[model samples]
Target: MEPQKINKGDRNKIYFLVIVIAALIGTNAYLFFKDRKQSERFVTVSAEKDKLRLEVEKIEVELDKVNALNLDLNDKLVEEQKLARVKIEELKASLEKAQITQVELDKANKQINELKTFVKSYNEQIIQLQKDNLFLKNSRDSLQNTLKNISNKASNLENENSSLNAKVKTAAVLKLQSAEIIAFRTKSSGKKVEVTRSSTAEKLSVRFTVIPNEIAEKGHHNIYLRVFDPAGNLLADEGNRFEADGQEMQYSHSIFINYNNDNSTYVIDWANPKPFIKGIYTVILYADGNTMGKAQVELR
Candidate 1:
């Protein structure tokens, strides 16, 4: 009996020890799993923080580029505005110059019309004078015929009248060549003027010829030439002598022959030290105190 009792107590003790060991192992496994989960959460949070930092840096770089581009665009816009302003000013000045030129042109046209009217009046007066002279000749012939029938005293008178009639016919037949402009040629400093893209100083040379009449007298007569710019403003050069006529004229660099000669040519040169812009240029010439011809030239 004593031995049985001791064996039972030993079995109970072993079972109790097995149960306690199982409980201790379960608690240890729970603790280890919780620690591992916390470590994984910490690693995830650290990775997310690093990614956000990189994204911020990229955004900052993009913003800086955008700011730089804006600055460049602003500078370009300002430059464009400045250029536009300058162009506007230039346009205004050109407009004013054009207005003044128009007024001057109108005045010149009026003067030209007046000159034409005067020429017409002169022609009418000459025709009237010729008619009167013819009438007088007829009346003198009748008187001479009557005198011849009466006596021989009209013989010397008839001879004087005949001589006077011959002189009148000779004077009436004298021809005058109308002043005419022949040709216009342009030249630079010493050579022919040419357009170039490069910025350089240049000169303009004008050459004109006068057409003379066959009956022009061989005497000293003054010849005049006038030049105007595209805007109709007088382009007078140095060494030009002013003469009769309501002409604000500058003489060309050279003159060839006097009036009352046959077909003489004249040349004038103007030096422009500034760069010439591309445009149309107009030139006019006058001879014998009248506008004889005109020409147009294009420079590019």
Candidate 2:
């Protein structure tokens, strides 16, 4: 049997096949290793991102605690705390992206560490602030104790002066039920009707009801009324001054009513000098040295 030798063309074809097979094998090896490296890089980056996110969340929790402490910190510290929280939020958002680079992860790690440092510093400051607040609170408590002793002595003195105090306090107490100011005018037929127009406003009718009080002394009592314009100026006539609890004050009008242990109604009319301005007017009632009631009227 004669062995047939391979032709040059066939040899070339076999070499070409071998070369193609070798190239494919090399390409497959390269692809496999490359995929493996990519997977490893992905896992590493994911781990870093997750770790940073967790760190950010921890920082967020600490920041919330700091804010919830309600410490009276300086404005600069407040701003710093706000900035730290914002940074943590930003880092979390960035880490949640679909794709992140190693360099970016590195930067995030650095930023997170810096934030941790900032939080530590902030915590130290908070501790110091707490100490200082405790000192201040202790000082305040000590002062309060001293003031309480002084107040006890003063209370003893006040007991010695109880009679005059009772007189002043009793004279200043008032139990008013209702107070109102009505604008009205007299018709030509000598009839009075309610009017809202300032031009027709001729009288400010002040009406009030005083309820009975067992604590208040029962006798003839004079009620004083002070009317004020919108500009907070007292509206009163000349020589309308009287002393209420040793304080001299000018009043718009005074009414004398026999208040006998029961509800008493009184009305005092104030003559308007000119047309009342279209604005809000305030009427305050005073008896003794204390304000009893207040009413407001709008003229249009």
Return the lDDT, model 1, position 279: 58
Which lDDT tens digits does candidate 1 get at residues 212-300? 45544455544444554445555556767664346555754334355544455555555543344455555555444545555555555
lDDT of 2 by residue, 1-300 (tens): 899999999999999999999999999999999999999988988888788888998998888898799889899998998888788888988999999988888899899999999999999999999999999999999999999999999998888689778876775488578888889999899998988877778888988887667767667777888888767888888899987656888998888767776776878888866568888888888876677888888888
Estimate TM-scores for all models: 0.29, 0.52
Q: Of the candidates shown, which would achieve the greatest TM-score relative to the real structure?
A: 2
Name the lDDT value of residue 184 in candidate 1. 21
Give the clashing pairs for model 1. 240-251
Query: What are the root-mean-square deviations of the candidates from the true structure over C-alphas?
Result: 44.3, 22.6
- Candidate 2 overall Cα lDDT vs. reference? 0.85
